[model samples]
Target chain A: MRIRRNLAGWMVIALVLVTMPALSAQSGKVTILGTWGGHELAAFEKVLEPFEAATGIDVQFTGTRDLPAVLTTRVAAGNPPDMAALPNPGQMLELAAGGHLVDLSQILDMDQLREDFAPVWLEMGSYDGKLVAIVLSADLKSLVWYNPKEFAARGYQVPTTWDELLALTEQIARDGHTAWSIGLESGAASGWPGTDWIEDIMLRTAGPEVYDQWVNHDIPWTHPAVRRAFEIFGEIARNPRYVYGGTTAVLSTNFGDAVNPLFTDPPRAFLHRQASFITSFITENNPGVVAGEDYDFFPLPAIDPQWGVPALGAADLIGVFRDTPETRALIRYLVTPGAQAIWVSELGKLSANRRVTPNAYPDELTRKMAQTLVEAEVFRFDGSDLMPPAVGSGAFWEGVLMYVGGEDLDTVLEFIEAAADDAYTSGAATD
Target chain B: MEREGASPLVHLVIILTCLVWILPTLGLLVSSVRPAHDVAATGWWTVLRNPFDLTQYTLQNYREVLGAAGMGRAFVNSLIITIPATLLTIGIAAFAAFAFAWFQFPGRDALFLVVVGLLVVPLQMTLIPILRLYSRLGLAGTFVGIWLAHVGYGLPFAIYLLRNFFGSLPADLFESAFIDGASPLTAFFRLALPLSVPALASLGIFQFLWVWNDLLVGLIYLGGSPSVAPLTVRLSTLVGSYGQSWHLLTAAAFVSMAVPMAVFFALQRYFVRGILAGAVKG
Candidate 1:
């Protein structure tokens, strides 16, 4: 009965096709599976038009946040998409570990990438000494976004050092305005923004080399540098005027949703120190404001020169499956200087291709950001992404909340250190 | 011997309990209608300050979400997957339940026990194998594939429910039919099945809601084909790699709830009867 129905369905399909135009000279399609949706959905679709026109290969895109999980299911079932773009390096590693990825070593031109994309990104996508993914846009996290008019009105200047950054917060607090708007509540993953704060602090206080050691577990979680990062973070979190609703509000507000009040009239708070992505949220809340006049970002200032905190960047890696001659051509087209140019001009995105000029960014601040990213001597990936997720996502977030709620620095550190040990012991790290 | 009126304390306690139970739902309702900025910055009660701020209460969210990412198609796909899964589960379970309750066969108890044993298998453990099977059969990423998967997973509890209702049917009725030389199928259709309406209706509503609200199975098997995805998948897509659009998310949440609420209310009269049927053996 099923076969008979299928036959009848085919006949219907044939009838429909007869009325429509027949296939052209080249019709083989490639499905680019990804999780970009909402505003980004429009951006990706716009970019795809030019690609399809150039290649004559039909490009079918399916967007969902659960794209990785869905792709896992599909690949396990032997019905994988032609290509998939996963945000985390760990996911690419997992796919390669499962032998689900097609090695791109022979095709992709790695030499053409940005000279300074924090080699850690390239390393993250490599497994068994083979490249599986290409780092796309990079996000520089060591930047603090602020209202330029508010700061100037308060006689505040952009802090050049960590001491100045701290002093400036106190100065802002003395003026009776809230110093920060720190919101980390992102349901089920409630404490990630707090984690980002800790990461920024670590990059500023501990230096990148120690940061790298902590990621590799060569330095224990209880190391002095790790402890100090928490101390500095807690100082701000505990100070009543530093954050509105302080500890409680930090726990209450959704991180993405938290940026809104800062952009409101009379401004709920003065500053938010998040990555470049927060611009989208700020843009959403304040409609007619331009970046340079209304808002801008300063590089996260250094506590001392030894801290190595000029910049920190994170990247989303794009990987391949079943690489063939056709797929090779596709990758070459995707990462070439020309393609990066299109991504910037059309999509308003930062491209990982170093050969492409940063001047292509539509906004002045983004172009400045691209220049700063290129000049940075040291860069680090998001520490949480490098750690085993069980500890990184679960324990780390929980630990940050505990610290914010006034748990002692040592106790919080010990709890996370033990959780990390359990994570490693359970074989979660090795895989 | 009756008191002239109930004690004020008792009345107050009942009102308080009702409020406590309804608090989260009320919060969600209020939060759903609120401006995304206000919801983010302050509590939902802020709306009470200037309740008539028509400017703040725009349907722009609803308009945007409905227009977002092929959600209209997802609604149709959800209905397509849910209706058949519900019907097929009820049909198969009814037949199986009738056999379990009325038929006599060697090892019938053991067979029923085996079916009950299946209830212990975690659905997650079986997901990979079942997915592989669907792909092998060319059923992966199809509407029929999801329906069959839902029905297969839904059957054990469904059979258990219907069998209890069938068992309570008066034994005299089946014997009377047997004496009249009516075949089992004819007796089932004419009498037993007709008497089992409440049970079937309740099961249908339950299975429909589960399949409709489901995200994991739909996502894994249906392939996010906008033409085939359900509300849950579409709602999740409103959130992107960077952040969420709460305006759209709130609207999407309300849209997904509308159909299920309608299904519940439409069947509510039968719902009460169905729930109480097996409790009274007559």
Candidate 2:
């Protein structure tokens, strides 16, 4: 009889243990998968602290560099997280098309989101006319970083037009210093910075309409507009006097280390074209460097006065995989200016929400960058990210390397065109 | 047999090879202690110029990785996954190898061929199907699930390796044991396993390191739940998505390397013998 009583006690404990996770999950918990870690992740946790305190909902964040692969596998295994932060719109669209993502318009307060964000962000985050993702942070790419002190000492004026920029480049070259430090190397993703150059130049030379057509492959790679952009980029990248260490150096230098030449005791290059995030790297590598004072940026000058300085940038978008009340609450909270201010201040990333004013940024340079993004005359997402992976990350990236490595322009264009043909056709067939 | 001494030229070549192999690890060790700015600013070899300046080094990277990155929990998870996975593979592989080597069973040769053939199957192809099955069985994201997956994936090579060693054993000892009224089980336990320590020890090290270093299997099965994540998974996430915070990766890499290095050194004697065991015959 005593043994029977003991067995009953053990059964109760076993039953409770088995049901514990389900019980906790039911109360208030949401799992978020993202590609952030270290400092960025810590900042995100801070962003969540207030929401967690107010609602008493537990937030679990899992960080992985391979988010797409992990998310795909989880979805296949029928165990996806409540939400996931997608690095690009491509994967978000793929997931949305698969009916794996919840329609954010249904869960989120659309009226508030419309007020918080610009229409461009909403449109970028939509698929099939339904809001599927919300961009959390953006990084401006069309900027030239130069040392303010060096520029002042050299009597170099920030160029605002393409002609003046060319004349300035000539003057800098004549001054016996390299005009630009263009680093094209990023392991396995080498040649991406080159792609950025082409994209930025494309926006300027061909205007936004043709740039869209180029990204969508409505126009062939051999089109005059595309070639013009590449040639304009080559004028700076290929010239031995224009780039620090010349073409070989441009191809060899790691993007992060490329800017080092500009910070040296005797600067090797006077200009570096990179995204806003380069500031963090600058401060990290060169200790005691102050933003705005030591270094500052101006928009990459207007090539066609009609187009103006269009912003080319990338953003991290969050999509809800499971539409629970907790997830809805979290999404609603994430869009608030208060939450966005904390995130931008902590991580030094620009917030997409227009309501997040410039003061939310930690420094004046970042404030200017945020303003540059918000007040741009025109804006477009990074062209490579919008293209199919086969052409975008694959052929387009390789073409940049080949072109800079002295491959003929015709051959490079044709090479990318062939891949785009195959990729776009198959991409359409699947859709 | 007396071995001739290596000539000076051969010695130089061997020394060069050792340097080439050790340089990267040496660089990693040096960089892990240096400040983040210093690491990014100059090559790790620059420290050799000012080796006496202790001010350049800091334990901040190590503290951040272990404390904030949650590598401390991951270190324990790696051990938990590796120890049981290694033992289970050895245990099961030893029994099967003994059966193939000694017992008279129908389809023994064909079954052995099938098990051996499994080695040619790539691990990636089975992840999805097995994961689907695991989720249905409520084993996904559990330590036991990963252990079983490791065992299953590890068994093909483990069994083949052990079978060859078991087959190479002197037949007289096993025959005499069986004739003295020893059961097949007794022979396996008392004779075969006892004689196969070198092979088993070597296999243990291989399995341990393989499971410890594995990221794909762990990521797929465990799904990066911090509670069950191994060191590899945690280490991969140490850097930002665009590979920022890479200085932390240097420290985290060494933290993960510490255990495998220790395991390899401890079983090193057996490892050398095990590699030579099947290669030579009297």
Candidate 3:
């Protein structure tokens, strides 16, 4: 009788402990952290609504730009949110390295992803060839946006090659308009626009093999190919008529504000080269100008046709934290075509899945943008973003400024190469 | 006649200085009231050009900031931390300064020297060891944790200033108080504190500002949860890779400033009096 009572008490205690998790975790709410503004948040809410209504999961969205800080602190405190939307690939890797992220391999199908993305983007979100982050959308940087009305009035044709581009720039100058409106100044990360210009030109001038070697740190920064790219950039940037504010414009003008003058009456600039995301800022500020009719884009002209202008883009990564059954469902939901359809329809975003047809783009420019994204044969994530912030937001941007501010190309390249080496090496040290 | 000629120039200089100082603040205030889209499209000063277009203005930014999770909680937390901190610091520093200035003891000058010397050590150098000590004491992430840390950090400057004012006190009054059989504590309360009001007021304002605007120490020791964080920590979250959300930022900044401004206005008379008293007494 005594033994049986003791056994019964132990069984009761074990059952209570086992059932406690079920009781505490009864509420099926999944929390997500993301940026506060734009169509992105609006879209996310729309996508999650159906899921929430179906499963009775209450979605608590924490809108914040500092997702990394919140995610890091919460994970350390052992109360991480279910999912987090990260803009930078490097941060996803950092979280993975710290043993904080859940292994998403079994949950996500990596083989079905678009093969056009730069290999580094693939590696940035992968640990030991196991996928950790699901890439949702991309922002392409190798397109030259221009006022179609102005181009038509001027009887201008889109340049097909580098020689034509330079000739066309001179022609546009003769036609009494700025050929390029380059603004790179973004404080702390001030020189990224210039870096994008360089990367775009390099893709047009230098082939993917050489680009890959440079990205992987195999090619020397002072290589002839690199020097040639800077010199070409300098020629256009330094030419007073080619850019609105000339070389100095790249330093003082805010990158977002650079496109403002281009939309002025008589068109301050005939050509403005920037990523697709800039369309929103442009169209928002300029009320009447239609995107597809008033303005159009052509891929940055090939310096040499063999190189093929590679698209410079960035991806938003969603990494899983806790591998509960619900978390797996969320991850699987995110990587699916249906999930992407909801994002595209609601968010006005470029989808990572080529199969999802984007219907709810904000404007004709974004419609063209959607088509361009789907048709892209090669896409590379922002190289600087792949680097640590100290380098990505620091020395890399500074090097671009130094070059624009009249530092010799060879010297800036050498410094950047050494800086990159030191940064990655030190990054290893911290880990 | 000589003073008359100088008055115009002095007024001109003062006006120019005020204009220069106030323009940016005015712009920030104006920007805070304008719609986010409008702010992005034009300069903040454009509103003054068309002040009657009230349709362009919006309280959406402030509404968003206030509605954010834990903002009210943070405001309450800041008050809880700052009020007691200011009072405790003034109370303790005033007492210590009175003793240091009036009493004669072994190492009297040397002890004063040591207290003053602490002012020179950089606060950053001591943060790590103190943080480690805090962890050992199980004080991290609690209100009491940050309060104690702030008290420790704020003491040297507080003690130094009060001691200077206390030292400047009229010794004859203290002697007279003693002769009347007033205890040291009674003499301090009756004679020292009353005369030292100017110093106390200035110190209170200075400490309040420091404790209010502080970010690093607060972030490190208190942890960056919305539940416990001050406005500075919340403001930092507005900055991310794309760029600062300037609309939200301006509103948040002004919201944080409202308290300090109110505190300053409420205490300005006392602050001015404190300075005047210090000058006269010294």
Candidate 4:
């Protein structure tokens, strides 16, 4: 009898403890989930401070590396957060198709948003003719980083066209130095850097229309356009004289550490093709090196003049699941120039908002990169992120590895095409 | 039993195996103390070129990891989750094992078979269903919910191991105790409990370490709420999503490993004996 009474008392206590949070969650609060942590999370929190002060709505943020799995489970359990910052549009499209996301066109001011954001940003964030997600920050990937000091000392000019780039590579090889340092290894995502190479080449050579068709699997993996992109990449990657330590080093070196050779004494490599974020790694490995002076970037030289200097990049998209008043208020605040300026200045990321001027960036190099992003004549999202996972992350990654490891290109293309056929067909059937 | 000494070749092989196992851990230890720039710029083995250069080492990584927001609270939360989960599983399994071993009850054999069968069910399979139930009960992010979940998942193996250990005890001891007019409760408390100390100690270590190192259960049930998250969850968030602040991971990993290493070393003597407890009849 005593033990039973004790258990009943504890049950009462547990009930009270569990109900407290639910009771306090009535109004004036919004919860968000995302994959940001460390300094990124801190910057996001700083951006939230003004909103919290003005609206008096409490914003609770949850950080996790496994956002997709957690978000799916939460949505399945009928308890999704008010908002979530998706890493890519692929997952957002999946959730929006399932009718789990709230259409932002109903909640946000469309005319104001259109004026602040570019058409490409809005188009990427829309699905089924309704805006469902919004992008706040972007990272430019079509860049070729080189040491300005070395280039000037060696009397080499920055290439502006594909022919000029080839001539520069040959000249550098003749000068008894490697032309490029390409590192494709990123742990399990090893060959993604190589995919970026192909995507950039595709945008330059075949134009954005074909790139979109290619990403959607409208064209088979064996198309001449795709093969041509691969062949162009091969000219630099397969030539022992053009790459730093031959194809073997390109296969083994980590993407983050690959740029260290460019900063070493008597610099082993001249040019590195990577995203704008590579500057962080360069400065980290070599302290006291100034950006824009010690190192600078030029656009990956145009392959076809018709396509012009196209931009290829990735961005973080924020989408809503529960449309409450506080959620509406917070979403409105997030896209404003006031909020975006703080976000970009603190984290050194490029804001997609046109109202956010270059002065919001921390350094001149970042301002230049932001300008490059905003001024591009043509811009497209990263191609691999748009395809089905079986081909994008699975076959495409492995195919690159096999191609670099000396497999025949024909066999590699066939392997990826087979996987794409299965993935896209089954993916459509499930939808 | 008497044992023969190993040959020189066996000794050499054992030494080589030990070296291979210890090399990575040694490198981690060395890297954890070095500055961030040095760690990224050169290999850990390079520090040995000037071994006495005390200026080459710093405790900044450890300081930063320990000082990161919510990490101290997370350490306490880990203890709060792990200790009770470990104790509850051991305590409940002990009584249940005693009942299955000595008590004459209806359907006892069938019940034991059912529990041993539960060991085959994967933990991942039950996460969503249990989470659904937990949400309905308003226990989704509560400490009590996680404790109950851990106990439920741990009970089957706990009972299997303890029942085997308790059954392997001599029947003469229980008979002698009952002959002396002792109740079943008294026999359980005074006889079976004392003799099963080694098995219990080993089981306690296993349960404690499993709960301490667990990430998925804590992540799913706790829902990334910083107030209830454990050390493993907090450590995972110390780096950026793309793993930008990876220089801090070596230190963060070492911090989480400290408690488990201490617990294992303290309770290691009974581990081997516990493994062999039920295998032999004599």
lDDT of 4 by residue, A229-252 (tens): 988998899889999999999999
User: By descending TM-score, how would the candidates be arranged?
Assistant: 2, 4, 1, 3
Error of 3 at A371 (Å): 3.8
Query: Per-residue alpha-carbon lDDT of model 3 for A1-431, expressed as tens digits?
Result: 55347657755654553343335445765656665443455567678877877777666555555455555655555555677778778778887888878877676665665353345555657886677787766667778888777777778888888788899999988977679888888765589888787777676678766766666556666778777878888888877788887777767888777777766776777777888767656655566667678767887876776766667777778888777777777777777667777776654457666566546555566667767756656667776676666667677788888998888877898788777777665432221
So what's the TM-score on candidate 3?
0.79
Maximum-DockQ candidate: 4
Q: Compared with the true structure, what per-residue lDDT tens digits does model 2 show for residues B1-282?
A: 535776889989999999999999999999999998888768999989989999988998888887865667788878778877887798899999999999898999999999999999999888778888988998887777888999999999999999989989999998888789999988887889888899999999999999999999998887676677888988887777767778988998888888999999999999988976566754
Docking class of 4: acceptable
DockQ, all candidates in order: 0.35, 0.44, 0.08, 0.46
Q: How accurate locally is residue B215 in candidate 1, as Cα lDDT from 0 to 100?
A: 87
Model 2, position A321, has a per-residue lDDT of: 94
Model 3 C-alpha lDDT per residue in residues B72-143, reported as the tens digit of each score: 767876776676667667877887888788898899889889888888887767656666666667555556
What lDDT would candidate 3 get against the real structure? 0.72
Among residues 3 or more apart in sequence or in different chains, the pairs in candidate 4 whose N, CA or C atoms overlap within 3 Å are none
CA lDDT of every candidate:
0.76, 0.87, 0.72, 0.87
C-alpha TM-scores of all predictions: 0.90, 0.94, 0.79, 0.93
Fraction of true contacts retained by every candidate, in order, equals: 0.47, 0.49, 0.03, 0.35
Say which prediction, candidate 1 or candidate 3, comes out ahead on lDDT.
Answer: 1
| Candidate number of the best TM-score | 2
lDDT of 1 by residue, A82-188 (tens): 78877667667778989988777667655654363346556767899887887766777877888888777768898888789888888878888777888878777
DockQ-based ranking, best first? 4, 2, 1, 3
**Per-residue lDDT of candidate 2, residues A367-394 (tens digit):** 8898898889889999898888888898
